[model samples]
Target chain A: MSALIEVKNLTLKFRTDEGLVTAVDDVSFTIDKGQVMGLVGESGSGKSVTAKALMHLNAKNAVYSPESKITLHTENGPVDVLSLKTARELKVVRGGAISMIFQEPMASFAPAITIGDQMVEQLQLHGDLSKAKAKAISVEMLDRVGISDPARRFDQYAFELSGGMRQRAMIAMALSTKPKLLIADEPTTALDVTIQAQVIDLMKDLVTEFHMGIIFITHDLGVIAQTADKVAVKYLGRIVEEGPVREVIRNPKHPYTQGLLAALPKLDDLDAPLTPVAGDIPSPLERPSGCVFHTRCPKIIGDVCKSKLPHDTQVDGSHRVACHLHTEVPA
Target chain B: MSETLIKARDLSVGFKIGSGFFGKSILKAVDHVDIDIEKGSFFGLVGESGSGKTTLGRALLKAVPITGGTAHYADGEVDYDLTTLAGPELKDYRKRAQLIFQDPYAALSPRMTVRDIIAEPLEVMGLTKTREETDARVREIAAKCRLNLEHLRRFPHAFSGGQRQRISIARALVSGPKFVVADESVAALDVSIQADVLNLLKELQRDLKITFLFISHDLSVVAHTCDHLAVMYLGRLVESAPTREVFKAPRHPYTKALFSAIPSLDPDDRGSAQKLEGEIPSPTNQPPGCKFHTRCPFVVDRCKVEEPVLEHPGDGHEVACHRWRELADTLAA
Candidate 1:
């Protein structure tokens, strides 16, 4: 199947007081229909920034490179995302083909409005449906997401619902639009583990039924491994590694990826000592000269790693990593 | 076994809710909890929200008012009944037991430098005779937390989440407490940075030989760090066991469901996991009888009427369940 969304050389920067700070640097990836791509990164790693750029939802100070391009394969045709300027033009991409949910359900929802009113409004805005039909669709969507007594919950405000319920409501609202690409940014980070498992299962089921491409952004490797088909590891705005989820989890190629996996507290082994990445992630202000990870990388070679940028190396048919230790650079 | 640092029997903490028309109903956040912590061991408390894990942790440290039962704290020479500690005894206990907050961003004062923030506890508690002595203690703890001397002069906002957490740890350790309650300490951190903070905590625990009450909802984290584990459900102790035993073979249905709920790293190994349905019951309006019966997959009719007491099942493991043996046998068959 052809890819659903393709992001190529998408360089994004914010105009901070300290000058242009690159949030996403030369990142490229693709997600096909019925596929789930996991964007994994730590804070300041720019995973959220990259996701935001897809819907043109970044802050006003965000400056995109001229060469950057994002193509969305909608039912109509392939449409360019970055060039859409007007809100009328942006509507087709914002909620039509793409829908996004956040880590904090409260932040995503309007606190004063009832969940039913908001969901119906979103449906009417995105599709040509009557108010009654939209309301019926909203309740059905809520019930589909496992929210019990959907009609009763429909009239409750965001505060009236519990954390898990609010998240489910948010998912219901997002999926009610039937967007071809769903971006879930740390959707389960604020939830309890059991609730998180339910949400993950619900999302997986939705993907199978709806056949929509999903971009799951989270820092938890376990969640990514369980939900994602393809995984992309980001560090300080750069894609350090990208591969099939099984291959990436089974045998990581990048040193940073290895450190992250090693650092996780594994359920199978209680005796293993968690070794953290050698040093702290460098401040965005002090962006490294050549290799972004050289300062913290454990297997750093001689001065070449310090002075030169590492090219991407193909480890297998699909696994790719960017590090000097993984590939030789021509003199 | 090592010397017992703290011991409690039938401890309960209750808060008055809706004073007017509700007639001041007592909401029992912690109901009849019994816990024992060995000296210098990591005792973990795991539970979902409204599970009373935080309240239970605070009760042991005397941060919350204990409504009933008795608690004793003894670290070799200094010994005091925590529930009845008062005046000079309470003041002394404050120095012996301390708490580390969950959010590092809000834990530290924005105006204070890192050195002053870490040194405030020493100065307030009269642990140091002079500023020089306070600085020395702050420097020692800061070095242990892997913070450089230059980082001491910066404000709390100047540092990252992991660095700020280290500063908070240094502050908590400046008073040289014997017992520490870390409530969801690393929950706000990234996974990689979480490992860093966890390692620092383990190292500090070893070097200083301080007993820790680690309260968190993450079972994987507790399994790796804690020597013993206690599972709480709606203010009750449902299960308690050694870390290895609990992970290897959990007896409580709630505990088993909780384990199965964790998303496995293997993509294809999504076993017929016993998924717990519904949210944790609110503490104010808790379920009658067994609190977990509302969500327990293997719940029976008997569980709907009578609450189960903690029963020992050998190997230092205690499970509160009416049908663990029967359930285990059925599963085996």
Candidate 2:
């Protein structure tokens, strides 16, 4: 299998009022074709910013390092995402080759626009289709999403639909363009558990059918456990742990991963007390030195964790963690 | 077992909608509910979004009007009928029975500092005679909620989602209430943060001996936090039993489907055999017979014509379903 996308030495900083906040620092990862990769992290961890960086959709305040590279696998050849400056030049990759779903469907969609029109407009942007043909395909896409009376629902506005339906419509709009990559940023956050389960099932099926690479970004460990083929745990914009989803969830080597997993409430054992990492997740503006997690880490040892950042240590052939505890300190 | 702290008999909550020209219809948010919550019990109300779990919690707190039936609240000294509670009795009940809202971000006054946010409850209820007393009470509860005294001086925006929820907890508890209604308190938080808040609540309940009416739409969270579980659907209680018993044997088809819907921590579990179909019916136009018969898979002809009453099947378990006996037999088989 070849890499569908490759991110290398990506470092992005924002000129916030507080200071220059490092959102994503030296973050590098790859997603293979047809694989679902989940970027797990809490708020302000910069998981969403990294996904935004892929589409070059960062705000004007963003400052990216020169060494940062983002390449997309396309029919023509490998295209550098950062090099595409022209709107027309970026269009091929933005919506044609890559599509993104947001946390709130209402924000992404026009409240007055019918669900079908938005989808048709998206298709029209990339493909040369007549109004009637686009309408037909839009109805088909809505039906594909398991929406009852697809034709009727397609005509209804976003507000008219339920929370679950709005999300499904957004998914439909994103997929109707037939993009190779889907950036789902907490797509199921607003949905109910049962509806979330259904949406997860739909996304899984879409991956199989479209052969699309998905960057499923969410704070939910359980959803990742059920869906993602591979997982990367992020802390303060850094990848602390990256491996196959099963290996990462079952035997996480990073203290942060262990803490996060231990914190999740479990139905299997109700008596367990969730020992959350000793303190609050530090603010992005006041990030701790040497190790980002040292501020809240229970097992922070000596001068090594306080003065020097640790290298990525391989726990197994497939698993890797960035922590001083995992590797011996240098003299 | 401790004496019943709350006894709600045939409780119903209805909202008069429209009011004039276009239409007029009675929206029954909670209808014909009967429940007994013992002192110090972590009683859970679980259901889907439109299932009236929150409404039931609010009704118990006297936040909503009780349209029909009687709800009795008696904790040793005071016994006040909820529907008729007013004046001094109602004011007193406000101090004893409080509600913790779902969203911490919205619940806390953003402009107010954490100290004032938590102290507002004590001040409003006149639980403390002076400002200093209120401040002292707020600090104590905040500390109990795992919030530091230093953090109390800052605004809510300065804290994390977890910390803000703790502030909300501090406010709910500063009144020194004997019973609390935590209505989806952990719903807005991440899974990791959820457990932290839940643990604090459990600890508070243990030390204070406060009976909690924990209401949530998520069954998995409820399964872990609650001792007794009550499943509500379309304003009706479908099933009520001990958490262990319900987890072991969910008598109602609704409860069975709910349990199966949860994405099991086990990897191999596909949730293929068990999946609920159709959305919950709109409350305004609820199905007449068994309100749930529209989506229930095992609905016999009788299920569509007559409503099922909450009946004791055996043990302490109660289920409102015509086919629960048959469902239980199938599970046994």
Candidate 3:
């Protein structure tokens, strides 16, 4: 279980018009080689921000804490991602070791350039490969990702392809460089169910072949259950629970995790009513004083849940929960 | 069992594509679709993008021009042919039917307050007499949607995605529409909030007795929320059945493939999905025979030449597949 990337004490805030809004607070997680870590969260949960922080891809308004650290291990050595200031120094972390695919492939791809051109450009930038070699590598990657007629598809622009193909092309482009870590932030969210399944299968096959660590971020518990080896449930910019995917999904320790699972419309039980988390997720500007999830936590014990933030309590060997109900022992 | 609130026979919506004389062609977005929405039933229409599920829903609502076929809107009290509906009847139909848009962020106007947003529909439809009457209706509907009266004064920018979606729902329901078309209404929402909105919609259906034409690509959500289901592919209704029957014994290949494609919550259930190959064909240039023959696994020579009409094998489960009879036998085994 050799770690590929390690993030610790990651506290991020954005300089907004209202005030400094905390996006990711004291969030720490790790991904190992050939493992998939699912970061599950809703809109304001800061899952995307945490993934962006891994590659130092946060917006200009983002301000990281002094104690924040992201360590990425490569063949060369362990590099501190935060310390890499210059673009030249950061290239090692950017596309060489870390590649990301977004929710919308169309937004990520350039309208004018063909999908092949983008892949070739990425390959040449990261590796000392000739133009012809780059083209061949791009075509092979496209074919590997299940794109039909790779040579003809190589000449087609992003707009020329359908939604599924565009997504496959994006996946093809990301894996062409053979990065050690792939951060796919809601990669299948924009796609249809059938296409989503296909993409998920492709990703699983890629993981087994490439043996690369993947950070799969999505709010979908089903997707997490199918794809992820480990799961981390985030709420209001903090990890409320973490455990093995099966354990976390089957027996979620945190109230937020339990609420999320209960909220899902299960196909197995069509008669069961969907039970949503009690209250709405509070605004970031007016964040709660203690636990961020206290407002919505159905298992809130007492004033302690509303007054003091609970520390992470280990439930089992690998399962851990951050809720006052689990952490505090009332006499 | 109940009275049919909306009925359509071979309804088609065609849009003229291309500009030049020779290049001009009619893109039949909704092609020869037959559907029935029983009163007080949640009917789910499921399909991938470009499948024309949205267009079919819109055509039913009279939001789009129906180029062919006939549709009827009979809520027991009022009976009107949706196709030839004009002038006062069309205006009256607008009050009876409404659409809930998918994206809450783009649906609501940022300039308008929540109160005005909900009230706009009522005022435009001339449902209320005065501002006092409009405010009363808005407050009533907003409260039903779990929106606070204080929150009504705030602009759309101040609310979250879930809150904005509630506002959208309140606006849609404020007009007191008997038939509502919710097109991917909860697709943009998170799973947690999505459940809340879905529950709200279900509650609204039971309390208000509104027939919802719920259009979405999510099979799991549709399975739980809807009483009846229709699967569309390439602008054609491939299968229509009771929700339980559709889940229990799906006759159509596309429908069965759709069910398998939904990612299971159990980790052990890996990629055993019946993966469908090839993309949905473009509506502009559909295949010669069955539109789905290109991707159909059991496709044969006959499927490529002659289109299969919707056939009821038994129990009112209509399936549009040339080989469904054989497929059902195999599925049974």
Candidate 4:
């Protein structure tokens, strides 16, 4: 299959009062058409920042490196995302071709306006559609998302809906535009397990039906395992491991990935002790000199880990890991 | 047999809602429930959003009022009836029972230093006579919680989520509580950090001999840490049993569904879980009969009209489902 989007050396940093905090450093990945790429990381790992960079949605204080390039392969041609400056020029990538769903569904929707109006407005903004046509498609998307009484729910405010229903409405709104790419940022984190199950099922079904590429960003590796075709394990703004979901999860190469997998409480083995990744994640301002994960890495090798960054080394056909253990000596 | 630290029979906690004298309605957050927590055991209470697990934890700590039924707390020295214990006896019970909140950021005061936050409890309870004594107690508990003594001088803002939680744990344990209620204490932290906190709690429970009523929605975490487990649905206990027993063979349909809902780490195990349809019903407008019947896949005519009572099905397992036996037989067949 052809690549839908290609990101090369996408480095981003925010100008804070303290200093320039590098949120996304030398990150690169690709998502094929109708494929889902999972970005798994803890807070401040720059997964969300990388996703936001795809649509040029970062704040004004954000700065991108000269080498950073994001090329969106549209039907017409490849569009450079970073080069787009004005809102009009960025419109094609923003909600036109790419749509985002936040963690909190309640905060995503307007409290005063009805759910139907917002969805209809989004549809109209993306393409040329009449008020009647927009409303018709909006209600259909709502019903398609498993919301009961779609017509009645369309007229109700966001506050009237429950947490699960509000999330369904948010999904419906995001999909109403029927964009080519969907960026779901911790969409199921706020939901309960049962409700989260429902949402995950809905997303999987939608992916099959729409055949759209998805960048699923979340901290839950379990959710990522279920939804993603390929997985990228990020830590401290860098991709520590990247490979097919099964390969990375089953045969992890990086110490950070292994630590993450070990930390999770597995239902199959209740007797196993939960061994956490040692030490706390360093503050973004203190960004480690060489390998960002060197502080907490249990499988540290020689002085190279502390002084020099390890380049991504191929473990198998598609599996790649950036760790001192995976790298070969220069001898 | 292990001693019972907390025993509740038909314990209920109801809050009156609405404003006017005429316009008043009771919201029974904790309905009629029976539970016995063995001393020195990590007992877990699992449920969804409106399952009343938090309310039950609070009622046991005497943080909320018990509108009906009875609850007893026994630790060999003092056995206080939680429902009626007031005045001096109630004041004494406060020190013996404490709570660890879910959000460490919200739970800790921004203005107070770690030392002051942990020492606040001892100072209020008068557990320590002098400033030196309070400092000593704070330092000792802080050390036990794996908090740095130098960091205690810094404000809560200086610490990360995991570190802040350690401070919260130190504050809760400062009073030397026998029975502690950890209500989603590790839920807010990342998975890697969550394990550290869980290990800390388990270690502390062993070292201090504290009986923890661990409340969380995540079954996987509870499976490894908690010895006994209770599943609640809409303010009612649907099932209660040993953790291994519940995981091996869950009797209640709700419990089975909960186990299946947890996303497996294996990518190939997709869509295998029996996903429950519909959201949890509002607490104010709860349905009659079985609270879980509205979302249950095996709802019968009787389940729609008549509620099931807790029944002992052997091996110390308790289930409140009428068709559990028949369902088990069918599964076996």
Candidate 5:
């Protein structure tokens, strides 16, 4: 299986009033078919932007480097995502090949229209279907997402449904398109614990049944561990560490990853105090030279970690980390 | 030893719903509940949005009026019934009880400087006679909250969500309150910044000896911060126990589901957990018997009509369930 989506040397910047605000810097990764790769980071880490760049979803002021290339694999051939100029040309990439879900389902959905209408509209965009058939398929998709009374709910407006139901409807709409890749941006962050659990199970089951690759983005490590097959930890627009979820959580090579892991409150244990990463996360405008994480890294090496960016060191098969300690010590 | 500092017995708070100003029907925000918060304890009230835990906390703080039963607040000096709090005595109660709102962005005024926001509580309470005294107290609380004095001159907009929360904590503490209601205080913050705010709250509790009613939907954050936990479901208390005990052996079916729902921080721990089905019923049309019976997996016919009363079988644990005896046997296995 070829790489479903490959991002090589991707650097995105926005020309602001002050100066160039670099959002994603030299970020490169690949998502194979049927794989779930999580992009984990706090705000300003550019995880969402990198996910959005797959479909060239950016402002007019946004600039991508000449070397930056986002290639998508298809039955026909490979297509550069950045080179697609118009909606017709980009249709194969956006909504056709990839579908994105946002944190707030209410905001993403059309308030005036019924949920079925939105799902039908989405289906109509990607495929040709009659009105009656679209309605039947939309209702079926709603039921598939575990929405009860699906037939009756087809006519009810978005506000009539609860938060969890609305989110399920959104998922159903996104999946109705039957895209190859799903970009879920903090899908369960705004939801309750029980609702979150249900959604997580649904997503996992959908992944198994649909056999679609997913780019799951979130700040919560716990959700990533449970939902994502592999994980990439980001700090200030840079990938500090990338590995399978189990490997990264159990034995993290990067200090930033370790700190984040320690910060999470475990249900199994409660006595331990939350140990925060020392020092504040620097403003994106004042990002540190060399390693972006060196400003807050607890295990920063002498001058090497400060002045020079550490090259990627292979910690194990498929696990790589960017840290001077791992690189210099030859881990 | 009088372990309990605040106790509410058969507390019920009602709100008039729909129609005219008088309204035709009453909605019970908090209904027939009993709870005991230990002296100087960090107590967690865990539930969903319409769980009534927030209303219960507000009722305890005298922020909302109590309509039924009684709540007693005692701390060495004199005991005051929360329901009948009136006149000059109520003013005293305001000083002892303060609330830290959920959204720091909405809670603080962007127009006011940090110093002014922190000092407003002290001034309104008339705790300090002069501005100098207020400043001194404000500065001390700010430092304890890990806020710089230089930043005090800046508006709330100048600070991040974490820093604004610190300022909120400083304000809540500046009143020198005995009881603090932290209503989803850290929910607005990011995962990494949440740790900093939690640590700050813990440190303040240690130094000030203030009891906090930490209300949140996030169970993990509550488990890490609170000493004791009370799980609420649709205006009712399902279970109350020590943090370790509740997390370890939750008696209520709702509590069990709450724990199981937490997406495991450990990757290996996934797939083994159970997920809950159905949504929480609206408080206005709550199901008879057990409020959670509509969604609970362990529901029987009897659970559908008879409301279970909170029964204490010794120790610090208390559970409100008819099937707890059967559950204990299965859970212990």
Candidate 6:
């Protein structure tokens, strides 16, 4: 499969009033065509920051490392995302080749504008389409996403629709641009379970039909298990473990990943105790010295975990984990 | 059986919506709900948004006005009728029951220190007399909730989501309430922190012997934490049973669909569970019969015309569905 996008040594920090807080530290990953890469992490795990770095969507206070690089392969050629400074130059990476859906559908949409108008505006901005054609395409996309009476819903405001319907509308709008890569940041977190299931099914279908690469970012391990082919578990600002979904979930290598899996309330075995990762995630300002997860690691291997960062050890053909438990110790 | 702490029969909470007089309509947020909470039981109430789970919780707490039916609070010492409860009786009930809000960030005041937030409830109820007494009470509850005594002087803004939630829990339990209504208390926290909070709640419930009414939308969470579970849809109680019983064999279609929709952790188990179609109907313009008829996969003709009452087939499992028995047999076949 052809590579859709590649991120290398991408370290991001925010210039805050107190100090420079590192958000994403040397995070690197690649998305292949039609593959779903699930970025799993807790609130401060930097999953969202890594997703935003792909589209250059972070705030003005954000700073990127000098060695950071993002290359998006398009029909034309390989486009360097960070090098594209101007809005005109960045358009190809924005809604043109990459589209994003947010957790809160209401916040993403304009209160005053109709759903149809917003969708058509997006399509027209990205491609050369007439107003009539864009409107037709938007309605078609809405119908495709399983919104009943799509034509009627096109004219309705975002508030007029239910939470489920609004989410479906947002998905339709995002896909209307026909982008190669879709970045869904907690898209189903706001919806009910039934609605979330429907949205997940729709996204899976869209992936196959359009053959588009998707970066699904969420704190929900269940959602990640269902939707993603590959999973990257993040802690603090580092990718602690990266592997095939089945391998990572069934047999997690990193202590942090194991803690997360153990923490989830399992259905098959309700008697299994919910073991939460020990201690609160330290503030980003006072990041741990060696491994980011060592402070809370259950199986601490002597003083090595506290002093030096562990290198990524290949577990299998496709699986990789960065933890002292997996890495070889020099005699 | 253990002592019934709170008992409700056809308890309903209604609110007037729309405009003045003629244009106004009553929105029944909690309708004809029957519940019995035994002392020291962690009872769970689960439903989607707009399903009146929160309304039912608040109604039981007397936070919302109970418009119809009867609710009794009997904790051996005080047996007061909740519907007609007022004056000193109501004031006393405030000390007996408390609510832990859902959003920890928004629930705690940004300006108030952790100590003051937890101490406010004690002072309001006049549980402690001297300043030292209030401080002593606050410190004890804070320690029970697993909060740092040093951090009690710091404002809420300095703490994380998990710590703030603990502060809220401490505040709710400071008055030494026998009953606590934790309304989606851990929904806002991350998964790792969510487990931590849930464990803390379970520990507190066991230690203090507090009858907890845990309200949440997440089924797996309720499954693990609660002893008894009640499933709600559009202000109606569809099913109520022990946690294990409900998970092992869910009778109501809505309950089954809710369990199915959780997105299994096993990747190989995808799409095996039945998915409910369509969104929940608007409460204002609800269907005439069963509220779940619109989305239920096993919905029959009888479901659209007449609402089914709760029926006990055996054990403590209560289900409200016309074809639950037949559906159960057929699924087994």
State how far residue A170 of model 5 sits from its true place (Å).
Answer: 0.8
Highest lDDT: which candidate?
4
Off by over 4 Å in 2: A329-331, B19-23, B271-273, B329-333
- lDDT (Cα, tens digit) per residue for candidate 1, span B153-219: 9999878889999998999988889999999999999988999999889988999998999999999
DockQ of model 6, rounded to 2 decimals: 0.84
Comparing only chain A of model 2 with the true chain A, what is the TM-score? 0.97
- lDDT of model number 1: 0.91
The sequence of per-residue lDDT tens digits that candidate 4 reaches over residues B69-175 is: 99999999999999889999999999999999999989999999999999999999889999999999999999999987898899998888999999999999999
- Residue-wise C-alpha lDDT for candidate 4, range A62-116, written one tens digit per residue: 9999999999999989999999989999989988889999999999998999999
Best by DockQ: 4
Candidate 5 chain A least-lDDT 10 residues: A276-285
CAPRI class of candidate 2: medium
Q: For each candidate, what's the DockQ? A: 0.76, 0.59, 0.85, 0.86, 0.73, 0.84
What is the C-alpha lDDT profile of model 5 across B1-333, one tens digit per residue?
646789999999999788876657888989989989988999999998789999999999898889999999997666899999899999998898899998999999989999999999888888899989988999998899888879899998777777888889999888888889999999988877899999888888888998999999998999999999999999999899998888778899888888888888878878687668888888888889988889888889999999899999998789999899889755533
Tens digits of per-residue lDDT, candidate 3, B204-295, equal 99999999999999999999999999999988999999999888888999988888899999999897777888788888889999999999
Clashes of each: 0, 0, 0, 0, 0, 0
lDDT of 3 by residue, A129-210 (tens): 9999999999998999999899999999999999999999998898888899999999999999989998999899999999
Kindly report which residue pairs in candidate 2 clash with one another: none
> What's the true lDDT of residue B203 in model 4?
98
Q: Write the per-residue lDDT of candidate 6 for residues A77-141, one digit (tens) a residue.
A: 99999988999998998988999999999999999999999999889988899999999999999
Interface residue Cα RMSD of candidate 1 after superposition: 1.1
Docking class of 6: high
Tens-place lDDT per residue, model 2, B1-333, is 679999999999999998777778899999999999998899999988888988899899999889999999999989989999999999999999998989998998889999999888777777789888887788788888888888989999998899999888888888889999999999888766787888899999999999999998788888888999999999999999999898887888888777766766544555463667767888988988899998888888999999999998569999999888778965422
